[model samples]
Target chain A: MNDLARTIEALLFIAPEPLEVATIQDITGEGPDGIAGALEEVRGRHGPDTGLELAEVAGGWALRTRGDLAAACDALRARPREDRLSPAALETLAVVAYLEPVTRREIGRLRGVDVDSTVSSLLDRGLIEEADRPHAGPTTYRTTTAFLERFGLARRGDLPTLERFELTGPEAGALRARLEHADLIAEAETGDA
Target chain B: MRGTNPAEGRAGDAGNLGGVPARDASAALTQEVEIDLFQGPFDLLLTLLLRDEVDLLELPLADLVEEAVTPATDERWEIDAASQLVLLLAAIADLKGRRMLGEEVEDEPDADALAMREALVGRLVAYAPFQRAALWLADRLRAAERPRYRRVPPGTATPVPVHDDPARLSAAIDRMVVAPPAPSLAHMGVVRRPLPELLVRLRDSLARLREVSFDRIVADCDRLEEALTLLAALELVRRGEAELRQDVPFGDILITGTRA
Candidate 1:
């Protein structure tokens, strides 16, 4: 088990991007149960003593700079902007990413704003692409692989959950509950009546 | 890859070194700017904010917004590019005013204020991830990227069939209608052999045999002629001169001459 854990640790350490348990299993030929146990062991190995973190991002395991050191590692992550997208462009991109194979008209409805300039900018940037529609309806857009890489995501399915962000109806109830929980925590900390 | 601290600075260095793999041939037709001066107003503000490291909540967003918008106040500002930023400013003002005013009205907190804050917060929360994504993309773009020129000349796209001019589109449809109705199977003209002739051929062939296989009869014929023969055979069977038998539906059909 320790040997398996060590091997998993080394693989996770060297990987540029996150690796899935299945990918590790393919290489190691371990069952999912065994792989999960080994990963747990590997996670234990990356405890308080080390700066390297064995964390799951986008449904895969990756070695990232530990959260405590994120501030110090900003320089490592920071890179110059060549051609950046504006907030509207970025919002349009988010809409396209969340609701992929999405029509421009549909995106317009979701954003409640015109997306003409933003759509063209995304096209020029190679971030989002015009997906071919089988029927001659409005052209739908999908995020390119370039988009996944740009966002540091392994796949489109790895997009961060937007239901909470939508902050609508039932999701608002969840948010309210979350606020109540925070209030409880605050009350506990204050020792107030 | 060895027992080294491979965490120093190799985030996105592996891929095509920051080059705009322009592989787009038709891009030449569109006048391309060498480098975008700035992506737009929001990106400009983000770049400014990223450079300054100002705390978003504490910082007066209105000042930065005013500075950004002031240039555009004359004939300079683009409505498309800067409208969202202005709206953002309005939201910021609303939030700031609410924060100041709503604190005093703690006894009866306004629902509108909370809702406005939630809306703005939600947008910012949503916008934050994309901003980070844009930054990453921008970084990748900054890395040693060279635009690849196209080797082959770009082919002209077929003219768009749908046009705003209804007359022109209808004229195009009219032209299509007028043009020699698609030369259409004319070169291989139809050869309609009489059904009675096929019936006579079948009668002569099946006279000795108790039964004849439909496939074997049509095996030597071309597709069109073979189809005609099959139809003629079916017609003969329908007329009761021959009986059709198949052990299984869709299996090989057998046509036997009726003794009667």
Candidate 2:
């Protein structure tokens, strides 16, 4: 690779977070076309067989452990992680993820619960943040790039649809039975006799 | 399996409802059976039930109310959870009753009831996608084998210390917002009269009275102006336009202009 590509690779390697192309341009004094070409070169250099892959995640370039090597890495070192999302947290995050720049009231309205603590927890984890704009309305929140990085998504559009979690055969059967029971109880209690 | 309900055997196993009579089993079903799909705040249970296609109008409200007010378990009820659950159930029950009443009496459906139902169903519908997304996220987290790499690990960096005193911060901002009292120019050095202007003025004064004593020229002048007058007298002497004489120590010098 040429000097530009090598320099870009070095910068991405050393950066604590993903490096944006504009940042690379600022540092290297390279034009957009030149930087794009160098990034492509850097990406190409890290082929599938390589341990680390140059991934474009969270709107920037990052060097990440290859998906297949994750198991081996886990065996090599037990990385300290406290990122497990509880069921409540996942639900709150899902609401924020899909309907972002949303207010606490809007989230509560949809989830049918108060989400104050959940919102604060997400904020502390750096997975979501308050939108920084002046307005007369209440404060709003949106997912951070850290959310995408942790979930291995390149962008919000990469998120899977909710249809994937739609109740399947057995699960659907169980829910149907519960509904039937509720109907029966309603009839018996209302003096249907 | 279709003819025989297995949930019947499992019913007694649910929360302290073992001795519940057959007549009250349905109420037990509503109150005791914990949903296996998702667990969260009691408020979310309504949406999950809605997602499962349980008609809100058909929910066993009277029986559920009995179960809520006097739960079968000896365990202390979470007051917040119980109160919120009762509030939601009451709202749904009210909506159900009004809709039924409208169907019986009114030729046209009640707009208020329709709006309320629409809002409730709309919340359910909107929340359904996120419920599914949450499951997907959980699955993704479980399946992810390798955590992302970091050259410098997170949480290692020292956090920037913050001054968190609200009153002081407010005062600081208030001080900034109101334009500072127009900066005092008293301490600033500003020449009221330029040396050149003073020099010209002194020469003109000498011309007006050719032999004026230095003390008379500076009688009304300040210290700075007095110093400037002395310099101007020297400049005149340098050009041979004036002469200075002091007969006694610490006496004022006399100036004599050369011009007629």
Name the best candidate (by TM-score).
2
- By summed lDDT, the worst window of 10 consecutive residues in model 1 chain B runs over B22-31
Query: Model 1: per-residue lDDT, tens digit, A15-77?
Result: 655678888998788899998899888878778778765655546776665646644555545
Question: Chain A TM-score per candidate?
Answer: 0.63, 0.79
- Candidate 2: which pairs clash? none
Off by over 4 Å in 2: A75-77, A156-181, A186-193, B1-122, B143-145, B153-260
lDDT of 1 at B226: 79
* Model 2: per-residue Cα lDDT at residue B23: 25
lDDT accuracy of residue A15 in candidate 2: 78
TM-score of each model, in listed order = 0.34, 0.48
lDDT of 2 at B152: 63
